[model samples]
Target: MHFLPHHLADLAALAQMALAFLALCLVGRFVGGRQAQFEIDALAGWGLLAALLTLWGVATTLSLRIPAAAFLAAALVAVIWPGRRPDRAAWGELGRLVVLVLPILAIMATILPSQSDIFMNLMPNAAYLVDHGTFPTAGAPDAHSFLPVAPYNTQLVPFLGSLVIGGFQAGGLALFTICLYLMAALLFARMLVTPIDGADARPETRPGWAATGFGILLVTLLNPGFVPRVAFAGYGEAPVAITLLFAGWLACRAMVAMTAGETGRTSLVQLALVLVALVNVKQQAIGMLIAFALAAILVAGYERQIGWRRAALAFGAAALPAMALYLVWRVFVLTRFPDGELKPLPFDEWNWGNLAPIFVSMGKVVVEKITFFACVAVLFVFLERRLRHRQLDATGKALGLAAATFLLYNGFLVVTYIGHFPGVMSVEAHSFFRYNTHLALLIEFALVVTIRNRLTPWLASCPSLARQAGVAAIVLALLVPVGFAKRLRFDFDQPQPVVRQLALQLAPELKDDDRVALLLPGDTNSVDWMLMSLLHFSAPRRPGLDVKPWDHADQAAFDEAAAEGYGLAFLSCTKGNSLGLPDHASALLRHGADGWEPVKVWPYPPVDPKQRWQPALAPGPLCRS
Candidate 1:
């Protein structure tokens, strides 16, 4: 009877959401009295409020019996109280946006495979940590520590995974991935609503406001650059993007408060933490921090908040903790390379001239990524006129800050990487192009919104120019999505046949407590899918399934394989055969003619002749010395 009611309740809740959104929009239009701006705001605000309330209601009903009921109840009370006032439209609007955006974002993340090998390595590490209450050594044969400060690299993510794996039970790779996905979306949402002094142009215009807010959100969400690297063969840009969005939001807010002669300690502290996290996660964001600092100086100068003594103290207070954490992490964890050795580059190589490629790469990354090359040309003329008239608002100013920071930081990277960039260009070595792509998307959104607002005034004065600019902005904005549509689709739907085939082939053979060695893609280090399936099949205590290195080979590698006790093996032919797995592996070898014999081969789909599969020519009975 309890189960029956629960299922019925679930269906009823979903039906309510569908009906509620429709009602909210109609109610918004009726109350707004045909004012586009008011209707837009009402639609977004009321829509959000309704959605949040609905979810809260359902969650309360579903989760009331749980121990954390008190906490949930308190949270709902606070959320409801804020919207009780007449001027709580923003709260409602945000709530509506949250409901509409968050679910879609979560779906996108859930559907995507965990494109991070780091997640796989972290889950197992978390398990070991739970049992031993200590960080494991990277040198330990069985331990899969991707970073030296194992606990830190494996931060909040693993605990989230522990929920599914049952208190650090063997594998929670999917759980960790889901946490990261949600965290990124949540951070993005928080950043969007966070007020920036310069970004709220024509705050009265609801469509404009909606466009700006949704634009920024889309910049973070829809940009192909946010997609995880393993799927795109990229890095953890999602984490970095989330970090930057949070940092940028805090920085913009601080600038706003400073402009109004108000100092926000919380914003200052947040900015500092974000900077620290940026450097900790991806060191290149250091350039972004430096550029933003310069922009802050510009903003302060423009607003006349240039009290050197006060500014210095405020910055020092915010920055000290991040710096301390960075110093500690660098000294303890980040210093050790995968080989367990620390290698530092020479001082001469770190200079501005050598760093030019980094900046260029960064610039190229932002521009090329959001298809800024196309949009800039379309929106530039109108923005130029708006700047001439001095109609640009706080949003414009913040955007300018972001754009300048991107160019400067990206330029710094370009100079640093370019001297050697020519040599490494072909190999795509340390390019830093992907991060730049995200920066570009951020810049483009700001530029488009600024241009969109500026053009309306010009429609009266220089109607001809206004018409051209309007047409261009709309066309470019439309095209921007098209440019990125391929990448997004790829992320959403591209077939990972190599990985799928490997997992499917190994699925039937898998049983409770059976360890399996699934091959990684050659030229890449992704492993979550294979590892997740293993967890799915064997829980609590699965046998040792070793994922052998496909990079450098040594005796220790062989020793690790022998320790795992894997009796069966499957390899991804695409993940090259020559790296770590030896020709005389106990279970299987690379093109060997020994005691081994072929069992089964499941090639990737499309079975095209060109779609090659390496035949596992094992040693048959006739083979002898």
Candidate 2:
């Protein structure tokens, strides 16, 4: 079967997601509290996938059906469980917002590049999980080296959705990441909008739809530092940002619950699961989880919102599940590959000399966000009197959490840099700003909460202006991610020509046990990894079987393996002067005793033949890596 055209592919992806999200949200709605329903559902959606991936990662299970069946059963239980119904109006509002924004989201997902370590790390792992129904063990074919330890939580969307789609589609993650970003915006808006009623919602007062929308735009579109390309480009940081924001949000609730002399059970499953999902996303996430937890507990203690002993117990209870799950994953990894490459912790390298430069460079990233920090300063002013009186509120707790986490996580980064990246740290802190973006949502949460008192009243007094502002915000929010993301030049499907063309050639020749040598050494504009991925996963099965990248083998070795009946095939998409094959254009060659014989001769990817910007055709440069 042919791969569906790009547009159809996205539709197929969203269809699967729509089902899995419903199942996931049902469990979230039942087990989780009704407050911040969107946040609960969105993060729960992420959490379920994380759980499934963690389970698959830890278990030697041979069937994807185990995770899939568990989800269906839990969702079924959540459905049949007797419970109060959810807020219809709130659900309606969220539904309307999703409808308004989905087209733009779909457009963005379609453009998410099939590049970078996506092919090397994320996609291969995801494709393997979906195709094989299990993650790669110590030695699995078609597995990239990082599969053993690289966090596959980010791969969950595509993996889970592929269960329904019958093959993996990478667009699901971008779509879900955008959706998570939306939920984060809404959650932050709720934090601010509620204050318009002076921190209490009056029974007769209308819901602040306009003000909610207003806050969303401010937190999302107006925040100049939010780069869509980075956030939506299948990075670990985007999901971490959402999970971290949820941590602060739910932690605020826990603070409030403890202050009121009760357990924060309402938010615990979600909060704990959010943490569960967080620590599993990346190794750095465990550091983030600790940092945020410390900030929350410390702030709670300092604010005296609850008795110190009681707060500590409650906070520890909340963190218990996450810590336990993290340990489970650790045990699984250690048992599976005791001497394998898991990238030595705190790194194997140390550089005392780099400390000064790392410190200075990291500080500069903070300074560059002067406006955000300036907002944080104002928040401190707002909380000063309350904290001085030993009577802080959830907003104050959120500020404390974000602030402390900012300090702690970045300081964690310094240690990480000295270890994991000492060489790069000698000059500058690597990806400092990008790493800091994980806290962007929480920072904006504090920013919005600080100003909510004044902004809400101002908006309420002028309903016309608020309504117009909401409309403009909606338009801008939809336009901004697409506009900025396009500027990054990844907004195209034309780049898949090499992959699309190669898959057509290989599917007809290779069998289940056959191996293919991907000798297309790429520089800045073409990629062999992505080509291999497309060949392995783009369709139901003219393609869906595994084809390992045997790049290390040269002509002689390939011929050697061929003589031994390995049926080795070498493919080069580059023009020439590659892999000891001189004066030859791109071709698929079968290694044999008679020397390498051409199985198929093809030019380097020509531009998409269709050319028009229609559903069936892609418009752009021919072979963009």
Candidate 3:
């Protein structure tokens, strides 16, 4: 599953992706320097600082090139600066990461974007920001549904993709998303490897850094709610999940540093940057950061290990950035898109009295997610084992942080349901499993850190075991995405990518004012309007590619279409049509004043990664009726 040197093309793409990432971190390093605490590595130093910088540019200049140019300068400085060079240990860690997870990177480097959110949210919004260069002065055009959702509106992952290859290429987005997860894993693993001062006498004897880190990545995917396809599909959860882990790590480390009498200045900067990332990544993130801070204070102030003054300092450091970012975004959103209508539910639907059922519903969801409970159960088991004696060490502290934050964050979620989302979504708690995923890694990594006391010895004896298991996981991660691409389900949704491919194939001939409509043999109401929406957003300035599904049964429908200038129509792949699309297959279409016309059928083929996901445009219309 590891990347091979012989795969030069993939290697180059991965390298470009990695260098782009390091370039962002380079800027972070230069901006932070001695003011930041990167006790392990500087991966999360700026915590979506690139995205924030890009947002400001979008607000002002409206070009990613501005931030790209800045990062390019950082890249140049990185090329010559002796201070920016990786230390020997860091170099070795880099090599280990390459060998252990190269295949996973390969998967990240190759997959195309097929997720609905890419079409509906990220890509359209990225295009809007780059094109308009400001917060939206108005709402979505009536012809298109490019309504950007709040909080998820931040374009870090998409911005990186655009920076890598023009705009929002799925491959680039995937690589960056995986890289984001990798950064979080490294932070967690580093925290795992390093013991609190004076807690472990033989910290040097610990093993499994890269392997354990890679395992942390696996734990994230192991999440029952984590559909790898969706996570990689340009949604905001994966980023939120990973960045929360990053912020959680930084927050906990700040307290640990406090206990060890490390200088507070750098710690404050580190906490602040991640806090900025956290708040911008999701609306609920401010609450999550508060949970983390409270957990940190509880653990650090245990028996007054750190005086209240220092704890208050750490609290101030975290709160200040979170408040500033939250307010900045709030003001931006309020002043610009005050009528933003893409909310999950309206406040008028709120029912505060529904808390008991919502709580029970949430409990059912939690109980159903055995994976989540196992995560918590491991913490309980480890905490029990470790605290058999009445002593709390760094491992114990992390366990408590995980437990404390888990309870607090879940409480915050209940508030959200009551205040903002109590409606039909409240029945199942609206993607409860998926939302919990944001904190899954923190708990999983905490368990990884705690279990070391039990596993490190056997692992030390069988040093190759961790490496081999991690290698297998790497193999599985690479192989798993292949299975997704092989079918048309959530991971690699049917028709969306293929429809986009068909649109691109037909784009050059499409007139700027023309709207495309799908001529389905029959309507099952499938595609969820996704196929047409994707095609509509496929072009720049939207170019009015307006896509609508054509009803073949009614001549009045055809007349209405002609009234609306529907000149281009394609025979859509439908069940009655046997889902087989022949390349150049002729179909009947009412081409405006031209009356009935025979046109080449639009091809919608199944995605097969084995064939590099080529759309199999065949030779005949397999339409049954």
Highest lDDT: give the candidate number: 2
lDDT of 2 by residue, 119-206 (tens): 5566666666776676666765445434545666766666666665666665666656666666666665566555421311122222
Q: Could you arrange the candidates by lDDT from highest to lowest?
A: 2, 3, 1
Clashes of 1: 35
Report the poorest 10 consecutive residues by lDDT, candidate 2.
196-205
Identify the candidate with maximal TM-score: 2
Better of 1 and 2 by lDDT: 2
Candidate 1, residues 1-625, lDDT tens digits: the string is: 1111233323332232233322333333322322222223222323233223223322343421232223234323433343322244544544444444433332222222334443344444444544433334454334444433432322323322222233443323332322333334333333333334533231432222333334434544454444433222223444455445555555556666665667765467546645554554445545565665665555444444545555556655555555555555445444333454223345454443434444444456556545544443444454455458764445655565555566576555554454333444512326465545545444544554454445546566887874564455334434443444434333322234344444555556545445444433222344433344334422333334444433222334333444566444444342233443333221233222342234554433333435333221111100100
Task: Give lDDT per model, in order.
Answer: 0.41, 0.62, 0.57
Higher-TM-score candidate among 1 and 2?
2
TM-score attained by model 3: 0.78
Model 2, C-alpha of 264: deviation from truth (Å): 3.3
Better by TM-score, candidate 3 or 1:
3
> C-alpha displacement of 209 in model 3, angstroms?
7.8
Over 558-608, each residue of candidate 3 has an lDDT whose tens digit, in order, gives 566677777766554433333243443324344845564545554344334
